[model samples]
Target: MTSSADAPRSGPVSAWAPLAIPAFRVLWFAQLGSNIGTWMQTVGAQWYLVDA
Candidate 1:
């Protein structure tokens, strides 16, 4: 059995490690902004078009 200290580390330790890379951070934020915009649009559409 491997002890916690002896275990081989795998993958990025920090959740934000992927965003540390310039290319990944750019793409991630772009996607995040797009998703936020889409969410706002959907909410606006529902508010304007749906009956109470």
Candidate 2:
């Protein structure tokens, strides 16, 4: 008896599956913004310490 997980997929796994869902898209963008903000703060802090 084969379990569903052992079955071969019909095609290549979709890379866009997450974007197809609205909630996932929202969360993805939110995290992206958060990462950008964090990195900017990190770089600014490093520069300040190095210059001072």
lDDT of each: 0.89, 0.94
Record all residue pairs in model 1 with backbone atoms less than 3 Å apart, i.e. clashing: none
lDDT of 2 at 23: 94
Whole-model lDDT for model 1 versus the true structure? 0.89
| Model 1 alpha-carbon drift over 4 Å, by segment | 1-12
* Candidate 1 lDDT tens digits, 1-52: 7899799788769887688799999999999999999999999999988865
TM-score to true structure, per model: 0.69, 0.76
Task: Residues 1-52, candidate 2: write the lDDT tens digits.
Answer: 9999799889777898779889999999999999999999999999999999
Top candidate by lDDT = 2
Model 2 segments more than 4 A misplaced: 1-9
Worst 10 residues of 2 by lDDT: 11-20
